[model samples]
Target: MISKDTVKEIKILALHIRMETMKAIGNLGFGHIGGALSITDTIAALYGGAMKYDPKNPQWEQRDWLVCSKGHAGPAIYSALALKGFFPVEELLTLNKPGTNLPSHCDRNLTKGIDMTTGSLGQGASLAVGVALGHKLDGRDNFTYLILGDGEIQEGQVWEAVLFAAQKKLDHLITFVDYNKKQLDGYTKDINDVGDIKSKFEAFGWHGQEIDGSNVIEIIEAIENAKQHKDKPSVIVLHTIKGKGWAFAEQELFNHHMNISRDQMEEALTVLSAELEGLVKE
Candidate 1:
């Protein structure tokens, strides 16, 4: 079990991830806001607590791996990596710019800490399975974590990877489904409703559970449980609110990808700054 102080620290880290992600995308005036905000807490939990990685040695042989299937949420993971010293935090402002290492989608070749280049939705799942199986074959104990968007799961390849992971009994592989309910077009239900993601993973033979994605403590506990279950791969379905944290983005219906004016960006920064102040006081 994680200590209370550690939980508080992780929560602060999550807040930092949200603030940095907002700042990075706000610099561009627009990007994948909804999915990036939705996955901040989960990414924080992984990078701040669960995952064993070295920022100084990103290619450490024993370090764990992360494959972001919902690669559009790259900004959030980038924020975490930056805060953890994977690279200079100032580079976040250069997202998607000419000659910038930070592309709109994650590129392992370009980024220092990224394990795999991912942007094609369902493909990351398959790649994650391959990485996990390879680690197992090499007699390594490190876990390969995969984060998938709820909308991305509509692709058939995700199911194939799920089945293959279970068949191989890749117990060291842990997956998180960011079920934020909103995709780029609109709501997931309005686009393609994936009914009961937990049940689907369970039926596919994974040890699955559903949790509140924004709750840091729940995320830590769920990951701990997943680590304990050694007979099968584990999947956590995170029920989250898309465009979380920032008031304007959270309430906006079409916030999946948005053009943020100077005023809007200032408002978001103000709100997040106040949130950080409150957390630090606590």
Candidate 2:
């Protein structure tokens, strides 16, 4: 079990990721907010505690790697990276602007901390598996983590990578499925219901677990459990709420991507600031 103080710190970090992500997206007036918000807590869990990385030396040979297969959630990762000192926090305001390092999708070439350039769905899954395998071949103990969207599993190539990871027994590879239920157009049930994500991964020879993605404690515990199993890769199905931290966006039908006016941004910022203050007071 994680200590109370560590849990509190993780919660604070998650809130910071959410606040910074909102600021970054709000700067552009619009972005893929729903998916980005859903994955903030998980990113916080990894960057804030579980993962081994160096902000000043992002390419350090001994550090672990992260590949966000759901690349549209790049804003959340950027927020965490900046907060961790991979770049200046002020740089987050330049997301997607001309010549900015942060883009709509994660690009290792452009960003300091991003491990792999991943925009096309299913491709990052493959890249993550290869990286994990490469690390194993080199006798390195570092782990490679990947985050995938619920809708992204519709791609056949993702399964191919899944099969390969199992065959190679990449025990150091960990994956998370942000099962937020909604995709860009509509709910996953209406579009393509990837039935029982955890069960499907288990069938594909992965050690699978499902947990509340928004809860930092559950996210941390799941990673701890995944570390105990050594025969196969692990996948944590993160049941999350799309647009989790924003009330208006959570209720909007088309929250996947939309324009946010200055007033809306101000309202969100005010609410988030209050929440952060509450956490700090605690």
Candidate 3:
């Protein structure tokens, strides 16, 4: 179980992720806002305490690995890494700019803490499976965590990787599906829905569960449960809001990729700043 102090810490980290992500995207006045913000809590849950790593030695052997298969959410991962001391928080503003390490999509070669370079949808699943199997082969207990988008799973490559992961009994591989219900052009339900992802993963011979994606305690508890079960890989279906923590984006129908004007960004920040202040004071 997650301790009270740990929960508070996660909450703080989640706020930082949200703020930095907004600031980074707000710098360019546009980005994949909806998806980037959606995974904030999950990213916080991992970096807050769940994952092991040394910012100074990002490639530490004993460290846990994360694959953000939904690579467009690079801003959120970048924010978490920066907050964790992987790099200067100021560099976050360089996102997607020429010669900058933080690209629009995650690139291991460019970023300090990124494990596998991921941009193409569903490809991260394959890379994550390989990372887990490699660890198992080398007799390492490190866990490989993967985050997939609900829309990304529509690709056949994701299913192939899922089948392979279960076949290998990769118990160390934990996958989180960001089921925010919105895709780029339309709602997931209206645009080729993969109904019941948890059951689908279970049918493929993996332990799967669905949970409230934005809840820090539930997210941590679910991760603990996934770690406890040893046999096949585990998949957690995160029922999340597409644009969580941001008022304007939350109500947008086509929020997958949208423009973030300065006023809109600051509006979101005002709300976040107040909550962050309250949390810190508590």
lDDT of each: 0.92, 0.93, 0.95
Q: Could you tell me which 10 consecutive residues in candidate 3 have the lowest summed lDDT?
A: 1-10
Q: In candidate 3, what are the lDDT values of residues 217-277, reduced to their tens digit? A: 9999999999999998999999999889998899999999989999989999999999999
TM-score of each: 0.98, 0.99, 0.99
lDDT of 1 by residue, 1-282 (tens): 689888888889988888888889988999998889989999999998799999999999999999998888899999999999999999999998999999989999999899999999999999999999999999999999999999999999999999999999999999999998877788889889998999999999999989999999999999999999987999999999889998788887787788887788788889888988998898
Give the local distance difference test score of model 2: 0.93
Question: Considering lDDT, where higher is better, how would the candidates rank from best to worst?
Answer: 3, 2, 1
Task: Give the Cα error of residue 121 in candidate 2, in Å.
Answer: 0.6
Models ranked on TM-score: 3, 2, 1
Worst 10 residues of 2 by lDDT: 252-261
Clashing pairs in 2: none
Task: Report model 3's TM-score to 2 decimal places.
Answer: 0.99
